[model samples]
Structure formats: structure tokens, C-alpha cells
Target: MASGLFALLDDIAAIAKVAAASVDDIGTMAVSSLDDTAAAAAKAAGVLVDDAAVAPRYVVGFSADREIPIVAKIARGSLKNKLLFLLPGALTLSYLLPVVITPLLMAGGAFLCFEGAEKLWEKLTPQDESADEDAAMDPATRERTMVSGAIRTDMILSAEIMAIALGTVEQEPIAEQAGALLVVALGITALVYGAVALIVKADDFGVFLARKRNGAVAALGRGLVIGMPTFLILLGWVGLLAMLWVGGHIIIDGLAKFGIGLPSDLLHAATEGVAGAGSLVAWLVEAGSAGLFGIAVGGIIAAALHAIPRKGH
Candidate 1:
């Protein structure tokens, strides 16, 4: 009896040890997975920034009560874009048409360049007719137009995000890749729209504060009301810059993969030249050079697009 009891205790101890080790293994895996996902998200910052920047325009004309709801709707569409559409499609592409990733990336990059250039062109050559048409539209029609435009833009930005995520998941197992992509999609959707919600409400917040009795509080509120519009305009410009920079980088990288190495070569040379300037300086120099290349490429594409003639109505 004594011998048997001692044997049972030993068996229990061994089982506990095994369970502990398994838990440790799982914890390690979770950490590693999260780290990898974060890195990939960082790599796709361009798309993320552009998405945030573009979403606010969708809610511009809506009543205060409707703005958040509209943003919510767009966010839902964005999720469907990634999880329902892009995720499975990306997996298929990875296994079946891996070679096409570079070309597809370049295509998306071209799209970003086109969009940025279009915005710039619109600003420089404002058309009174279009402005008049917009001003003439009823609230419902304007809202519809804005929602459709936002969804269409979301499709392109979502595609770019998925591609960047897919590229980063190359080494992971298929299941892990899918999980990571879903996480990234949901996370970014929440983040972008959440910020939009706050931005849209900021004016209301300012007005509420302005009604308060305290002079300092009213002054702060007035500042917010005055500053928000400028901030948004600046945000739009920044978004355009981000799109061009990111798009250019994607095209250049894609080109390098296909044996055209000029962009990477230039980046490397610049990095080396700035090596003695310290790590931060070197990194900035490399990024700045890449951005310049992106701007040049975007400009060329914009010029070509303009040069093409359109059909008469």
C-alpha cells in the first residue's frame, strides 16, 4: 500500500511538470506571434495613415448625430473588405500566384500615386462646375455620394494593407497567417474609425466648452474650434504625402525584386554616405531619399495621366 501511494504521487508530479512546460510553450508562442504582427503593422503604416486621413471626408456633410454612424458603416465595410474578401483571396494568391505579388503591389502603388496626384491637381485647378454641382446636391444625395466614395477608397487602401500583411506572413503557418491578417484588419479598422469619431465630435466638444462660465475654458474651446479645420486640412496633405511615399516605396521595392535595382541602390548609397551621422540621421536620410523617389515617380505618373486625352461627353 505504501509503495503504491508513493508511485501515484510521482505520477502526479510528472503530469504537473508536463502541463507547466506546455503552458510556458504557449505563452512564448503568443508573445512571438504578437511581436511579428506588430512589426508587420508598422511596415504597413503608409496604408494605415492614408486610411485614417481619407475616412473623415466621408462624414463631412452629415449632421452631428449621423457622423459617427456613417463612420461606423464605413468601418464595417472596411472589415468586410479585409476579412470576408481580402483574407481568403490573399491566401489563394500566396499559394497559387505567388509570383504576381510584386506586380500587384506595384499596381496598388500606382493607384495610390494616382489618388495623391488627383487630390493635388484638384486643389491646384479647382473646377467651379464640380463645386457648384456639389453645392447644389441635397443632403441625402451628398451623403450617398460620400459613403460610396469612402467605400471605394477603402477598397484600394484595404487591398494595399492586405498585401503588406501577406508579404510579412510569408514564413508563418497558414493558420497563423490568417489569424494575424484578421487581427491586423480588425485592429486597424477600429483604430482609424475610432480616431475619426473623436475628430468629428471635437467641434461639438469645443462648442460645449465655449458655453461654460470660465474664461480660460471658453478660450480653450474657441482655440479648438478655430484649430480643428486647419488641422484637418494639414492632415489631408500629410495623407497625400504618405500615399505618395508609400506607393513609391512599394513600386521601387517591386522593381528591385524584378532585377531593376536602381531604387534600392540609391537608398543604400545614401545610407552609407550618412553612416557617420549616427543611426537616427542615417535612417532619416534613407527615408527622405526614398520619399523623393516616390514623389518623382508620382509626378511622372500624374503628368502621363494628364497627357492622356478624354472622350467628349
Candidate 2:
């Protein structure tokens, strides 16, 4: 009876040891997987900044009362786009047809460039005030139109974000890949819309602050009230350039993947050849190259698109 009890104790001890080893292995893997996800998420930082920059303009021209709601509507749509559409599509493509992903990313990027260029064209050629249909829209219709447009833009940027994440994690086990993409998708959406909400509401915050009892606080608020518009204008320009830069970057990457690597090679060479320049210079060179490329492609697309409506008319 004592011998039997000893044998059972030994068996239990062996099982415990095995279980401990298994847990340790899983812990190591989980840490490594998280590290990879963080690295992958970093890759999407460019598009993420562009996403945030692109968002605030949609709330422009709306009444103060409607601004938050407009932002909310767009945020919901962006989340939906990421959680429902882009995430699953990214995973599916990774499994079945990974090769097509780059071109699709490029296509979306081209659309972004077109959007940026068209906006620039609008800036250059002011519209007739009396003939502005969208401006003539009722408040509700205008909100819907703006929200819809914002959501559409979010879709592409979100796709880029997910695709970038997918590229980094495609070699991992399916579960880890899914987990990383999921974390990125949720994290980025929360970050972007949260910042946008703060931005759109910053003026109100400023007004509130300006109305405070403390003189210093009030002065700070007044500063924000005065500074917000200039900041917004600056943001608009950033969004525009971001569209081109991101779009151009995506197109160059796609082209390289397809064996048409000249643009990518030249871009690399140019960035590397800058002698004695700091990291900032190299970054600017890359950005400028991508922006120029985007402008060229976007210009062609914008011309065709603008011409089509006139011909139809």
C-alpha cells in the first residue's frame, strides 16, 4: 500500500513538471508574438498619422452642435470597416491569395492620391458659390454626405494599416496572425478617432478653459481658441500631403513587388545618397519623392475623372 502511494506521487510529480514546462514555452511564445505585433504596428505609423490628419476636415462647415455627432458617425463607420471588412479580408487573402494584396493596396493608395489631388484642384479653382450643390444641402444631408465621405476614406487607410500588419505577421501561425491584426485594428481605430474627437472638440475645450476663473487658465484657453484654426489649416495641408505620400509609397512598393523596381530603387538610392544628412533629411527626401510620385499619378487620375463629368454634361 505504501509502495503504491509512492508510485502515484511520482506520477503526479512528473505531470506537474510537464505542465510547468508547457506553460513556460507558451509564455515565451506569447511574449515573442506580442513583440512582433508591436513591431508590425509600428510599420503602420505613417498611415496612422495620415488617418488622423485626414479625419478632422470632414467636420468642417458643420454647425458646432453637429460636429461631435458627425465625428461619432464617422468613427463608428471606421471601426466597422476595420472590424468587419478589412480584418477578415486581410486574413483570408493571406491564406488564399497573398500575391494580390500588394496591388490591391496600391489601388487603394491611388484612390487616396486622387482624393488629395482633387482637393488640391478644388483649392486652385474655386467653385462658384451659387452652384454648390453640396453646400445647398440641408443640414442633415450635409452631415450624411460628409460622414459618408469620411468613412470611405477611413476604409482605405484602415486597409493599409491591416495590410501592413499582415505583411509582418503572415509567417506566424494563423492564430497569432489573427491576434496581432486584431490588436492593431482595435488599437489604431481607438487611437485615431479618440484623437479626432479631442481635436474637433478642442475649440470647445478652449472656450471652456477661457471662461475659467483662473487668469492663467483663461489665457491659455484664449490661446487655444486663437490657435485652433491655424492648427486646423495646418492639419488640412498635412492630410493632403499625407494622402500623396502614403499613396505614392504604396504604389512604389507594389511596383517593386511586380518586378518594376526602378521607382523603388531610385527612391532608396536617393535617400541613401544624402551625405552627412541627419535622419530628418532622409525622411524628408523619402516623403518628397513619394509625394511627387503621388502628385503625378493623382494628377493623371484627377484629370480623367474631372473630364468625365464634363463630357457627360
Candidate 3:
């Protein structure tokens, strides 16, 4: 009877060891998978940052209370763009028409170039637009317009980010690809909109602080309120720069995939040449060269667009 009991205990111990080993294996696999997914996500950082930087513009005219709610709605729409629409579409494209990815990426790049060029043009050709127009609109109407515009912009950036992420994913099981994409999409959207919420509310926080009796705190709050507009403008410019850099990089990479690798090659050589100078210097040189190339390409395209005649009988 004692021997029987000992045998049973040994059997239970063996089972426990097996379970522990299985759990460890799963943990190891998950860690490896997460590392790969993170690298892919990092590759799409330019688009992600641009998305976060651009979203605040859409909430410009809203009341303080409306800012967060509007951002939440836009964030929801962005998620829908990624999950309900883009995920299935991307998967189908990956499986059915793998060749289309390069073309699609190039198209998105062209779009980014066009948008950046348009913003540059708008800046160069200033118009005195009336704030009263926004002031006159009902809150609901304004909110709708802002949400629509934001979603449209988000669709473009989201497409680029999704494509980049999809491209980086290995030819793993479809489930793994899906898992990586979902992680990237949710992570990016949360990051962008969460930052947007903080940015939009920052001035209000400043105002609250300014009401405090402490002189230094009130002064700091005053500075914050005063600086917010400039900071937003700076953010807009940074977004444009990101668009240009990301757009140019995508086009260069796409062209290389299609066997036109000269541009990227030249950029790479330039980057390498600057490497001996210092890390920061090398990076700036590379980025500046890329940005200049992007600007030139964008300008040429913009010029060609202007030269084309509009259709009107």
C-alpha cells in the first residue's frame, strides 16, 4: 500500500515538471515574437509620430470639454480603420496579390509628398482665413467636420503604417501576422491619441495652475498658456518633416524593390561618409539629405500637378 502511494506521488511530480516546461516554452516563444513585432513597429515609427503630431490640428477650435471627447471619437475611428477594415484587407492583399504591396506603398508615398507640398504651398501663399467662420458653426457641425477630416488623414497614415508593418512581418503563420498587426495597430493608436489628449488638455491644466496663489506656479502656468500655440505650430512643422522623410524613404525603398536602387544607394553612401564625423552628425546629414531629396521630389510633383489642365468643358 505504501509503495502504491509513493508511485502515485511520483507520477504527479512528473506531470508538474512537464507542465512547467511547457509554460517556459510558451514564454520563450512569446518573448521572441514580441521582439520581432517591436522591431517592425519601430520601422513604422515615422508614420506613427506624424499621425500623433497631425491629430491635434483637428481639435483646434473645440471647447476644452469637447477636446478629449472628439479625440476619443477619432481614436475609435482610427481603430476601426486598422481592425475592421485594414486588417482583413491587408491580409487578403498579402495572400492574394503580394506584388501589390510595393505599388501601394509607392502610392502612399506619393500622397505624403503631395500633402507636404500642399502645406508648404499654403505657408508660402498665405491667406487671411476668418476664425469667425469656425466660431459661427454649431459645435456639432464643427465636431463632425473635424472628425471627418481627421479620419481621412488618419486613413492615409494608417495605410502607410500598416503596409510597413505588414512588409516587415515574416512569412509566418497567418495567425502570427494577424497578432503582430493587431498589436502594432492598437499600440500606435493608443500612443497617438493618448498624447493628443494630453496636449489638448495641457492649456487647461495651465489655467488651473495659474489660478493658484503661488507666484512661481502662476508664472509657469502663464508661460505654458503662452507657449502652447507656438508648440503646436512647431508640432505641425515636425509632422510635415516626418511626412517628407517617411514618404521619401518609402519611395526610395519601393523603387529599389523594383530595381531602381540608385537614389537609395547614393543616400546610403552619403550616410556612410558622414559616419566618421560623429553619430549625431551622421544622422543629421543623412536625415537632411533625405529631407532635401523629398522636398525636391515633392516640389517637382507639385509643379507638374499645377501645370496640368483641369477638366471643364
Candidate 4:
């Protein structure tokens, strides 16, 4: 009886040891998965930044008290689009038509470049402004319309972000790929909306501070009110550059994979020839070349599309 009791204790100890090892393995995998997801998501910065830049527009007409809540609602919608819709669709595409991922990604990249270039073109070209009569609208109706528009826009950008992320981890196991994309979807939505929340409320914060009697606080508040616009403009510029860079890189790399490597090879050689230039310079050179290529491609596509007449018209 004593020996049997001792044997049971030993078996229980062995089970505990096994359970501990399994837990450790799971923890390690979770860390590794998160790390991989972050790296892959970073590759999709173009869409991420565009999402961030565009989001503030949704809150423009809202009262200061309602800005954060509006952003939160949009964020929730964005999350739903990503997790419930985009994530599963992306995973299915990755699994079923693996061969199509690269070309699809390149297409998405081209679309991004086209969008960024279009924004630039619009900036350069003057528009004929006709004075249009305004219809009176209730505030609630306006807010609802704005939120709907923002969420609809987010759906497109989220799709691009998910596609880029999915392409980045196509080689991973399906489970890992799903996990990575889940992380990216939640993480990026939070990031973009969080930044938007801050942006829309910044002026209100500045106003509050400016009302303070303290001289230093007032100065700081004034600075914030002054600087927010400039900062937003800078962010837009950054987002445009990222779109060009990322789109260009995707096209160049996709072409290289299809045995048309001349452009990339030439760019690489030219960059490499720079004496004492490190990886950073090489990356910049590559990025610049890619941006130029993307812009050219995007411009041609945009022009061609513009030349076509609409069927309904």
C-alpha cells in the first residue's frame, strides 16, 4: 500500500512537469508569433498611415464632446471589418490560391500608388469651384453620415492592409498566419483610431490650456493649436511617401520573382557601387527607385482610366 501511494505521487509530479513544459512552449510561440506579426504589419505602413491620415476627417463637424466617441464608433466598425470579414477572407485566399497572392498584392500596391499620385495631382490641379446651395441638415444626421462614410473608407484601406499582411506571411502555417493577421487587424485599428482620437481633440485640449491663467500653459496651448495643422500636413506627406515606397517595392519584387529582374538588379548594383554606403543607403536608393517606378506605373494607369468614359453617363 505504501509503495502504491508513492507511485501515484511520482505520476502526479511527472504530469505537472509535462504541463509546465507545454505552457512554456505556448508562451514562446505566442511571443514569436507577435514578433512576426509586428514585422509583417510594418511592411504595410503605407495603408496604415493613410488610414490614420484619413480618419480625422470623419470627426470634423462633431462637437468636442462627441469627437472621441465618434472615433471610437469608427474604430469599432474598422475592427469588425478586419476581424470578421477581412481576416477570414485573407486566410482563405492564402490557403486556396497561394499563387495568386503576389500578383494580387502587387495590384493592391498599384492601387495605393495611384491613390497617392491622384492626391498629389489634385493638389497641383486647380478645381473650378461653383457656388452650390447648401441643404440644412440636423447634427445627428450629419454625424451618422460622416461615420458611415468613414467606415466605408476604412473597409477599403483595411482590405489593403490585410492583403499586404497576408502576403508577407504566406509561407507560415495557416494557424500562425491567422494569428499574425489577427494581431495586425486589432493592433493597427487601435493605432490608427487612437491617433485620430488625439488629433481631433487636440484643438479642444489646446483651447482648454489656452484658457488657463498660467503664462507657460497658455503658451504651450497656443503652440499646440498652431502646430496641429502643420503636424497633420507632415503626416499626410509621410503617408504619401510610404504609399509610393511600399507600392514600388511590391511591384519591383513581384516582377523579379517572375524572372524580370533587370530593373531591380540595376538599381541594386547602382546602390551597391556607392563606396562605404551601408544598408540604410541601399534601402533608400531602392525605395527611391521603387517610388519612381510606382509613380510612373500609377500615372499611366490613372491616365488610362481617366480617358475612359463612364457607361452610365
lDDT per residue as tens, model 2, 159-274:
87777667665665566557666666666676678778888899989999999999999999999999988887776676677678878888898899889999999999989987
| Model 1 per-residue lDDT tens digits across residues 192-307 | 77777887888999999999999999988999899989978877777776677777778878889989998888888989998999998996786567667776777788889779
Q: Which ten residues in a row have the lowest lDDT in candidate 2?
A: 1-10
- lDDT measured at residue 204 in model 1 versus the true structure, 0 to 100: 90
Once fitted onto the true fold, the runs of candidate 3 whose alpha carbons sit more than 4 angstroms away are 1-43, 128-136, 311-313
Q: Write the per-residue lDDT of candidate 3 for residues 1-313, one digit (tens) a residue.
A: 1122223323322232223234245455544455444433433565666777788888887778889999999999999999998988888888888889889988888778778877877877977786667677888998998898899889889888888777755354556557657766776677678878888888999999899999999998998899988888877777787678777777887889989999989989999998889988986777677677778778889998889999991
- How close is each model in CA RMSD to the real structure? 12.0, 12.6, 12.0, 11.8
Model 2, residue 78: C-alpha shift (Å)? 1.3
lDDT per model, in order?
A: 0.72, 0.74, 0.74, 0.73
- On the 0 to 100 scale, the lDDT of residue 221 in model 2 is 96
- Per TM-score, what order, best first? 3, 1, 4, 2
For candidate 4, the TM-score is: 0.82
Evaluate model 1: give its TM-score: 0.83
* Poorest 10 consecutive residues by lDDT, candidate 3: 1-10
Error of 1 at 263 (Å): 1.3
Listed per model in order, the count of residue pairs whose N, CA or C atoms clash below 3 Å is 0, 0, 0, 0
Stretches of candidate 1 off by over 4 Å are 1-39, 124-130
Candidate 2 global CA lDDT score: 0.74
TM-score of 2: 0.80
**Error of model 3, residue 248, in angstroms:** 0.5
Query: What does candidate 1 score in Cα RMSD to the true structure?
Result: 12.0
